[model samples]
Target: MSRAFNFCAGPAALPEAVLRQAQAELLEWGAERASVMEVSHRGAAFEALVAQAEADLRSLMGIPDDYAVLFLQGGATQQFALLPMNLAAPGQGADYVVSGHWSQRAVAEGEPHVRTRVLVDAADAAGLYLRAPEVDAAAVDPDAAYLHYCHNETIHGVEFPAVPDSGAVPLVGDFSSTILSRPLDVARFGVIYAGAQKNIGPSGLALVIVRRDLLERAGQPRARVLTWAAHARAGSLLHTPPTFSIYLAALVFAWLREMGGLEVMAAINQRKAQRLYHAIDDSEGFYRNPVDPASRSWMNVPFWLHDEGLNAAFLEESREAGLLALKGHREIGGLRASLYNAMPEAGVAALTDFMGDFARRKG
Candidate 1:
């Protein structure tokens, strides 16, 4: 049986090649007659797997030797609190660029733990999130612990086309929805984190890349599990880690490396997004993407049908046509097509073709 093209925001699509490989090794991962999940994380087999994973990820991202990559549990949402807890000193504030729902949540989570300063809130007068606001470098507080921003706003379909200028402040990014979809300058940020469910692998794992120097700045966290230093000290094996998720993520990293890493992936992703956006743009007022063109997200594209009454029918037909998870979030009812790395060009082509056909019939 063939697989359907999945457009889920998370726990999303993974490379079919990786899935097949995992299926082949489900019972025995190597010479050891046990699956990767069954093996002790402390064992040599798992250790080697993790090391290779880190190496491949580093190579793929061009991560520096001065940075430490930690494969952690809990999703990116957990980091909302942990980041401020670990990075900020008593009474010290962190600056945030509130572009959409996730960034707003990060600020709310950090407020009780530390002083949270809003640098730029991108919402319009109606509180609608539609663009990435421009940052004034002069307004950023130099004494702030770090300047935090979401690399991509998954829900709002907004993305920072380039890294924001932080001036003297160290940049921190929540890259959950955008990581590995393109090349990133790891050296520009104090920390970068992503949940492994989207482009990486499955849920239950978050990958954090932190600059070595900044690790010492981590204060006593509210909990031991929340400390970046502790996780770094134990090599992300502080406790029983998410073994299966990490193993799957390792497979993804290897798969990414084989596909010529992020540089190649970026080009493919760009083309996929372009084709879909063209379909929407050429729909002759039948569909609309509200996001600012400059801040449009390459990974997630959300568009609305002019006739809202047609949404259910559109989604039903899309699902029947082997395009799954095309329904947008309930908060913002429309349609969203998440074009993660694993979503092939063929999927985008099929979706665009369907959209064109549907528009011609219904318009």
Candidate 2:
């Protein structure tokens, strides 16, 4: 049987070639004839793998020498708390621009650890997260430990039009959904972090890119394991790392490089997004995407049916047609399609074709 087109938000789709490579090597990885998971991270072969992975990532993203990249366990949610603990003093000010569910959750998680302040709340008059909020550079506190924002909200299908200006204050971004989708200006921000599941490879691993100088700050004391500086110094092998996830992410990095890196990816991703959004818009009363056009997420596109009663029929038929995981998040129920890098353009074409057919019969 053929593989189904998956549109899951996190633990999203991965490139078919990467999966084939992993399968080919799953039985025997190195000299010991052991899987990567069975091998010792301290071993030379696995250490080399880690080194190459970091080098590939650095090359793909054009990370500067002044920054350190750490691959650690726990998803981006853990970073919500760790960000404050590692970047700020006890209850020192940290400015957050709440754009959607994830950023709001970041504020909730960081409040206990740092002096959290809301710079811009994107909620509409009806308290709906249907639009992306803009952050003003002047409103940012210069003395604040860091300015925090979510570059893309996976749940709400909203994205920042561009990186918000932070001036002298260090800007920290949760780029979990849109990290490798396009080229980035790494030097513009103090730190950027993402969970591996969405665009990289899988869950159980998270990536952090931070400036070396920020690591020198006397942050709120915590376990060395939870400290970013310790992980950076130890080269992200503070303890038993998620070797399998790292291995998978490394393969993804190689795939991205072979495919011409972020420049190629950005064009492909933009085309994919435009095709899907156009389907939604052209559907007239048959479908609707509530997000503002300027703030629409290129990664996750959430939409609704004119007649909500037909939701189950649409999902069932789409599944039968090999389109899987089209259901929206439970928080805001409707339909969502997450177009991660690993998701082929053909998948989006398949989805739009299915959508048009469904709307015609069920409209």
Candidate 3:
């Protein structure tokens, strides 16, 4: 059977070329005869692989030397707790703009560690976030440790069209879903972190690109293990790392380079999103995406069917048609198609075609 187009939010699609390369080298990697997973993380082979992964990512993202890139375990959720602990002083105020689910989660997780303040809550009258909130640099408290926002919300499908300026206060972003889907200005952010499952590779890994100066802020006292500075000092080799996930991520980074880097990926991604959104809009009332046009997500597109009764049938038929994981997140039930870096243009074409056929019969 052929591979189906997978649109899961995380553990999302990875480039086929990367997967093929990983499969080819799974048995014996490098000049040695052992699998990459079996090699010691501190050993020459794996260490070199990690170095190359960081270098490739640095090149791909144009990260400055002033920033220390750390590949850590425990996903982005872990970073929420660690962010305040590593970047903010105990009981210090940190401003957060709650645009959607993930940003809201970040506030909930960080509140215990710091005086988390809501700078902007983008929810409408019904508590639905259909747009990204306006965040002016003036709104950020000058005395705050940092101003935080999510780059994109996977469930609610609201995305910030531009970086929110935070003036002198360090600007932090939770860039999980939209990390590598396009080019980014690394200089504008103090710390940019993402879960590897969506655009990077697989689960069990989180990538943090933090400015070196911020690491010296002497945040709340915590275990050396939870300290971002400790991890950076050790070169992300302080303990047992997620070897397999890092290996896959390294391959993915290489694949992105071969595909002409982020600029090319951005064009392809925009086209895919535009095509899918056009299909939704052209269908009249058959389908609707409630997100504001200016703030609509290029990575995760969540749309609703006019008739709620067709939800089950839509899922069943979409599956039969080889369009996988069209179900919406439980928090907002409708439909979602996460177009990560790896989903091919052909997949979007096929999905749009399926939508048209389904609507013709069901509308």
Name the candidate that leads on lDDT: 3
Give the lDDT ranking, best first.
3, 2, 1
Which parts of model 1 are misplaced by more than 4 Å? none
Once model 2 is optimally superposed onto the true structure by TM-score, how far is the C-alpha of residue 39 displaced, in angstroms? Answer: 0.5
Please give each candidate's TM-score.
0.98, 0.98, 0.99
Clash count for candidate 2 is 0
Mark the 10 consecutive residues where model 3 has the least summed lDDT. Answer: 23-32
Winner on TM-score (1 vs 3): 3
lDDT tens per residue, model 3, 1-363: 788998888789889998888888888997779888899998988899999999999999999999999999999999999999998887789999999999999999999999999999999999999999999889799989999999999899999999988999999999999998999999999999999999999999999999999999899989999999999999999999999999999999999999999999999999999999999999998999989999999999999999989999999999988889999999999999999999999999999999999999999
Ordered by TM-score, highest first, the candidates read 3, 2, 1
Residue 244's lDDT in candidate 2: 95
What does the lDDT read for residue 31 in candidate 3? 79
- In angstroms, the error of model 1 at 335 is 0.5
User: Global lDDT for candidate 3?
Assistant: 0.94
Model 2 stretches with alpha carbons more than 4 Å out: none
User: Residue 223's C-alpha lDDT in candidate 2?
Assistant: 91
